[model samples]
Target: MSHPQAKIHRMSELVEPIATVTFSEVPNEAFLALGMRDYWDGYFAGRAAPLGQAPAEVVHAVFYNFADGEVARHIPWVWGKITPQEAIAVRERGTAAALRQLLGPLVGSPGLVRAADLATRAAVSAPTEGRALYAGLRTLDVPEDPVARLWHAATLLREHRGDGHNAALLAHGIGGTQAHVLMALSLGMKAEEFGRVHHLPRARLATVVDGLRGRGLVNADGGFTDAGREVKERIETLTDELAAPPYDVLSADELDELTAGLEPIAAAARGHDD
Candidate 1:
C-alpha cells in the first residue's frame, strides 16, 4: 500500500469536485435564502477565522473561494458573529441539495453508498486537530439524509484538511498572495482564476510575486523554483499528515473503492461546467 497519509489524501482528492464544482455551481439559492451575499461573507469569514479573529483579514483569506467582486460586495457586512451551526446549516442545505441533484439519477449505482460511507467513517476520526474553524463545524449536528450525511462527512473532512493546510501555510510564514501563487504553481490553477477569487490589486500581487522570486521560491516567469517545489512538497506532506486521521478508518481496498466511485461522479460534475 502507499503511505497511509498519501492513501488518505489520494482518496480525499476524489471527493473534492463535489465542493469545488457541484456545490459552487449550484445556485446560491441557499445563501440567498439565508441573506445572500451577506451570509456568504459571514459564513466563510467565520470558518476562516479559526486560527484567530479575522485571521488573514476579510479580503485575502482563502477558506472559501470568493469571486473578484465578492470581497468588494460583502466586506462591509458583519463578521465574527456568524455561529458555526448557522454556517454549517447553510452549508449542508446547499451541499445536500446540490449532491442530490448531481448524483440523484445514479442512485442505484454501485459504490455510491460505499463512497459516502468511507467519508462518513473517516470523519469520525478527523476532529483531533486544534483548529477552531474545523472544531466549530465539527460540533454541528450531522444530518440523517443519506446525501446530506455524505456531504456533512465530506465537509468535515474538507474543512479538517483545509484547516490543516492553513495551519501549514501559517507555520511556513507564507502569506495569502504567495499561498495562492503556490497553489497555481503546484496545481496548475490560473492567475486569472486566483485574481477572480481574491480582491487584491495586481500591483500588490506583482510585488508578492517578485518577493517570491527574490526568496527563490518562484521563478521569474511565475512558476515554482526548485526551492519552492521542495517547500510545496513539504507542505503537502504535512497536509496529508493532518488529513490522515479521518482516513485511518478506511482500508486500502476501501480507499480504492471510494476513489473509483467518485471518479465518474467528479467527471459528471465537471461535465456540467460552463
Candidate 2:
C-alpha cells in the first residue's frame, strides 16, 4: 500500500490547476482519492467527464510540463474557498516554513531566506502577470496583410520561453495581455494556433488580430512584424531581470545539502517520477 503521505501529495497536486482555471466546483475528500470523478460528478453533474481531458492530464501538464517540475506533485491540496492571491500567500507561507524546517542551516542564512521568500511570492502571483503580458503583445507593429498580422501577433502571444508561469509572474509587474502573448510565443505558436489553445471565439480572435495589426504588433498574415520582435526581446529581458536566480546566495555545497532531504520528499510526492 502507498504511504498515507504520498497519497496526500498526489491529491494536492491535482487541485491547483482545477482551481487555476476557475473550476466552479470545489475539491473535497473524494476528489483527493479517486481523482476528479467524484468532485466533478457532484458539481458538474453529467457534463463532467468531457471537462477537457482527465484531471490527471491537466495536473501532469502543470506539475511536469508547464512549470518544469518547480512545483512538486505531492504537495497537498489547499483547503478553503480562496482567491488565487490568497492561495499564493498561503503556499508561500508553507514553503517558507518547510524550507526552514528541512534546510534550516542554509535557508536561515542571511539573504538566502529573503531571496527564497521573494521567489515564492513572485511565483504564487503569476496570473496577474498573465494579464499584463497579453496586453503588451497587443501593441506590436502591424503588417500589410490582415492574416499575416494576426499570425504575427499570435506567435508573440504564446511564447512560453522559460515557462508560462514565469511569464505570468513577470506580467504582474507589466501587463496581463503582454504576459499571455509572451506565453504564446514561447510555446512556438502562430496567430491561429494561439486562438486554438486559448479557445478564442472566432469573432473575438479575429477582432484581436485586427486590433494588434493596427497597433503594429503583427503582419497581415498574422506573424510578428519587426516591431513585434523588439517588443518580444524587451519582455524577455525584463523577465530575466525580475526572475529569482536559482539558489540565490547559497553556496553549491549548501544547496546540495538542502536538496538531499528535500529531494526524497519531492520524490515521494511525485512517486519517483523525476
Best by TM-score: 1
RMSD of each: 4.3, 18.0
lDDT (10s digit) by residue, model 2, range 1-274: 1223332233223222211221222223323333333442222211122122224334333222222222122222222233223333332233233323433344434343332233222223223243333223233333333222222222222222224445534453323333444456556776446642355455655665676677787778767778766677676555443332322334444434433423433332232122
lDDT for every model?
A: 0.63, 0.36
Among these predicted structures, which one has the highest lDDT? Answer: 1
> Cα lDDT of model 2 overall?
0.36
Candidate 1 RMSD to the real structure: 4.3
lDDT of 2 at 35: 39
How does model 1 fare in lDDT? 0.63
Misplaced by over 4 Å in model 2 are 1-178, 195-197, 245-248, 251-274
lDDT of 1 by residue, 104-128 (tens): 5755455666666777877766556
